[model samples]
Target: MELDCTAVIADVWLMLDGECDESTRARLQHHMDTCSPCIEAYGIEEKIKGLLSRKCGGDRAPDSLRDRLTLEIRKSVTVTRIETTEA
Candidate 1:
């Protein structure tokens, strides 16, 4: 059977996140083993994920920033509720 590259691409994130089942992982690994394009794509994705993990790992979000975001979200939700009630 021909491998469905589109389906594989769609599930790449799940595969990378280690959320896929054993069967799925095996299928993806098989595909990657035989397909150079897929292997290169996977390598790029792995690098990107690694870079993002490093960049966002520590002290990325200050507590004050989080608190302010929470306050803003609450204020927006309150305003939205009032607007919906009036409408």
Candidate 2:
């Protein structure tokens, strides 16, 4: 499939994260290789991903906290909206 700048911008995250498959990767890579704007975006995203990996990849939440969060997530939630009064 032919890709434009918008397509590359949209998929930069997938490419940077290595989430897309090889064929899609190749297509995005090819476009990035040839297109200046796509390449610039790709470079910026690459750096951001790299920085995030170095900063946050090693941190993990405590198991107790994780369990509490999991338990809370399993419970149902209810939302109620209150009407606002205006003078």
Candidate 3:
């Protein structure tokens, strides 16, 4: 199956956070292995996630903030999915 970089980029956090299934992780990693843009995006996302983890290692986000972030992430993923499929 062909991989969509936008979808892969959107799921970078999922891969980094170990939230995806093994097959999904393998698929993403394989795409990164061959796709420079995706790997680059993944690297940037990895750094951001690492920074967030270090800054807020033990702290929980406020419910409002967490809800906002989740909503925004879903919106982004939804848009990415739509754009990728339409292309």
Query: lDDT-based ranking, best first?
Result: 3, 1, 2
Cα distance off (Å), candidate 3, residue 40: 0.6
lDDT of 3 at 31: 93
Best-matching candidate per lDDT: 3
How many clashing pairs per prediction, in order?
Answer: 0, 0, 0
Cα displacement (Å) at residue 37, model 2: 0.9
Where does model 2 exceed 4 Å of error?
A: 59-87
- TM-scores for all candidates? 0.60, 0.61, 0.73
- Model 1 vs. true fold: TM: 0.60
lDDT of each: 0.71, 0.69, 0.83
Expressed as tens digits, the lDDT of each residue in 1-87 for candidate 3 is 778776787678778978899999999999999999889988998898788889987686797995687568868877977887899
Candidate 1 lDDT at 63 equals 67
lDDT of 1 by residue, 4-86 (tens): 55555545656786878999899998988888877887788788768877888854567698568556655665676578779
Give the per-residue lDDT digits (tens) of candidate 2, residues 14-37. Answer: 777677899999999888888997
Residue 76 local lDDT, model 2: 19
Give me the runs in candidate 3 sitting further than 4 Å from their true place.
Answer: 61-71, 77-87
List per-candidate RMSD values in Å.
Answer: 12.8, 11.5, 3.5
